[model samples]
Target: MNTQEYMSRFKRFYWITLTALLVAASIRPGFADEALSRRDRQTGFLVVAEDRGFIGNEEIIDEFQLFAKTRNASLIFVTDERTGKYLRNSLDRLLKKGAERIVVIPLFISAAAPRYELVHQLLEREKLDVPVSYTRPYGESYFAVEDLADKFRTIPQPADTNLIVVGYGAVDSDSERKMQADWKRIAEKAAAGFGFASINILIGHDKKKKDDDAVARTEKLTRELADAVNGDGDGGRKTVVIPFHLGPKLDSMMSFDARLQQLLPPGTKFLADGGSEVRADANSATINLATWLQREANQSQPLAREDVGVVILSHGSDFNWNETMREAVQPLMKQYKIEFVFSMADQPTIERALRKLEQRGAKAAVIVRVFAMESSFRKPVERMIGLDIEGVAQDTADVHAGYGHSHGHGAAPSVPAPRIRTSLPIQTVGGLGASPLFAAALLERARTLSKNPARDTVILIAHGSGSDHQNELWTQALEDMAEQMRKSGGKEFHAIRVATWREDWPDKRAPWVDKIRAMVEDAKTEGGKAIVIPARTTGQGPEDKFLSGLEYDLGSGFAPHPMFVQWVDEQVRVGLARFADIRRTGMTTVEAKSHSPYPEKWLWW
Candidate 1:
């Protein structure tokens, strides 16, 4: 169809869709009156996502309508490809429906996209009586990475898995490059936690797929993929393919399995992310997007500070563990209502905390997970809070078609996962592995045992994950913290090293213990005393059991340190600010000034 003809049909369809939405919505007994009343007090919201070709899933459409009604905002959703023709009408519709002011959400991966500019220009040129605000795109947000990670979690074994992500790129070379860069950013962050043996990203281009070059391009891609899975030393590793395109139609268009079947190993499989004719991220049709919308909708309507609460989620074992966590976070009670839950994202425990916060009249909550890395316990916690989802529905179809797996090589979860419901505006901050505070804590612990910087080798140790990929990540997190320490007066130490003892994984424990012993032996050759310090949350974790013959001083981990309190306090402030950020800039943290948890008389250690 011609541009004008296609637009005419689309506009008619758009009008019919909204009209049908209104008619269906009014049928709810008392919802219409209450919703219209709420919208009267809220700013209108316009969210534009990419043209994913399929935007008409009834279940998805109902979710969006309900999201709009709950926010009490005249919310409109459109695609980037249709905005030039559809946005003006949508804006007019919002105004007619009762919006005096509006917020435009261009939900692209990066603000560098040309659509980002067109949005501001269109808003300026088509100025209505109502005021409007423009915000940044998803652009490097943790939420976008979490979106992909949710899909990866279902795979059986991440550490031993080889990942191949197939993407449908922009037709233009320059646009394609930018798009690939953004995709790489999301891919890296999402995969960092998994420690996949290898990651291969393939972006397909129309120019290469043209009739003239199709055969050559097919041959080239075949060889390239063969080398990736076979000759590149990842041959034996289990490989999982992700079709990163908008929908299942693209999967058929690519004909991935038919073309590459000869190259794949027997156990190779595809992740089930395209259950929907259209994937959620293509059009930003996710509950994560809805939660973000809820946050923005509440921007102008500020809740009192007293109405906000903080929930500190941590790992606890026994009485000493839980009590130490409580003592560490006690100072936070002065500034905000606080509830500390020391469980591994336990549903019942988290629900009880939410209920307490609700009883305290909290309209919002900041969830802080206290672990070594951001990816730790992230999926389960997020799914419980209704912020992320798994691509479960498509698995059945993939397996039936013989391109999926029925079981995984990795160990299963110790407990069942159960989701909870809540209406509070919630923002969650991840672990403190990368935090300067954590690095400083490590330095302080080392200092307690270091008699002479030139003669001491400080070894930082932690209880690590059973998954090899996760264990590698734990080691990397400790290394990152060590780097931070080295920059901040840790240069005075003779040497600082990092290690992860895969404590829970009996099969993996002996090798890690041997490595620790070798490091200690290396330290002794230079007449250096090895100072082994626990990098754990609290207590000595199997350090003595493994290092019995070694001569090293073992200092308490972060348990008694004042900086631990500071880290929790910092997260609380950051979480609150992120929840209220209407612009989605990802720059939600400010320096902790007078509110620093450390008292002058207290030692940092």
Candidate 2:
């Protein structure tokens, strides 16, 4: 190669490398810069970050820019490096683009990272002050943990794997403790999603420290890895190491990979190199990091209790039935702000209700679902509200399309389905069907018709589901309610039986209705007055049609009862607590079996 040609190519490569290491870069207010032009109001995000030491992953970085654009926010990505001039310039440019204020987010995985104070030092140097707000670092984000778990799912059998999570540590002793606590939570969240047989969490520092504790930890981990590899039988269990470490240069990753090779067991799968290799701008290029930014922006304006609202999701019915639900819900509005959504988790209806709540200045919403079973229409509603992942990744390409998730190119402008777009932070609490409170309420209804407990056979019937599995769940719920009722006051009743009318499907309805009729006859023949109760949310249903000439007195359903309103009030409280936890911890999984209804909950899905 000629000297002139070689020198020219070297210069180009060097400048490209240097610019990528810029420590600080800015997307102007509302991305109004000519290159990313969009004239929109801005929320300010000063994402405190460090360099991600890998290459070839600009697609993730673009997602962040796309997020910034959609968020109508100004993002000034900062690294606590000697880039004060660059930092100042980005800030100045953002302000010049008309952002009213700046929110400085130390976007580290741990708040204890020593360089975080560098942001303050750099800011002090400029001294041209405007309103500056600070939210906590990205350490507490549950979505970031989810991102790790997303990687964990790649292993063939998560149930048999041992997980080792390496944390990027802080230098300060107290900071390190706090950082470790956060990392432990991160690991726990990941474990909640995938069943890792065992998990070990260790803080991985930029520079290795020479200390007894660090040495002991290393020895213990090394011994475990070795034991796993050398174990008998079907060989040792597989180990998966997830590192939270990052660095400014490519060499850092190479060293990390080498160290992992030594620390990991022989059969371990070390995926330091992946299909989506980090490139160009690795530090500010992750959906998790971007979500952290979005979370910070949301938390910037915490809602007052009065500013938050409530949503009651119920299965809708005809005029009189619907009116009964509306009337029952009226008293709750006096104590709390509420919107009643009467639909079987219809997405468009939910979107309309959530937006209406947002328009009413509700920054947070407590959504309470009322259904015959917790599993009924719950997943679809949860998915709509971002509580669940859209699908099981079957037909992954198609699944990605639903969320506007693009590969190798860019993110789609908008998501088309399975999610509703709204600014309100929502936390849903429901499965009233599984509550002891509902059981007590049912008992109250039975009490009104019981002239003699010994001679009474209470028949609890519900408007049932079509799926045999769901019908089974419905049966269990009824049995649970019957048990609760027994414990409450109905113990002396001859028997409390449960049945479903299979109210909707014609193919199944006839047989179930016949079964319903036969149960009344059995009660009558047993010399007990049959007290048939519609365990519904409103007025008594088609029991009159089926029970026709059979002599059976019907008890009122759950509506208009003081306990029904009490259940709503109690759920509001739970919803509020969950919302607080989500906002405080930034967990995206919502309630993951956190409030699971029945252990056999899997049958509903």
Which candidate ranks first by TM-score, i.e. highest? 2
- List model 2 lDDT by residue over 291-406, tens digit each: 44554566564455676688888877777777788889898776666887887666787788877886775767777878756655555666566555311212211111111111
lDDT comparing candidate 1 with the true structure: 0.59
lDDT of 1 by residue, 113-149 (tens): 4444456555556757776655435443445666666
State candidate 2's TM-score.
Answer: 0.55
* C-alpha lDDT of residue 206 in model 2: 43
- Scored against the true structure, residue 192 in model 2 reaches a CA lDDT of 63
For lDDT, the strongest prediction is 2
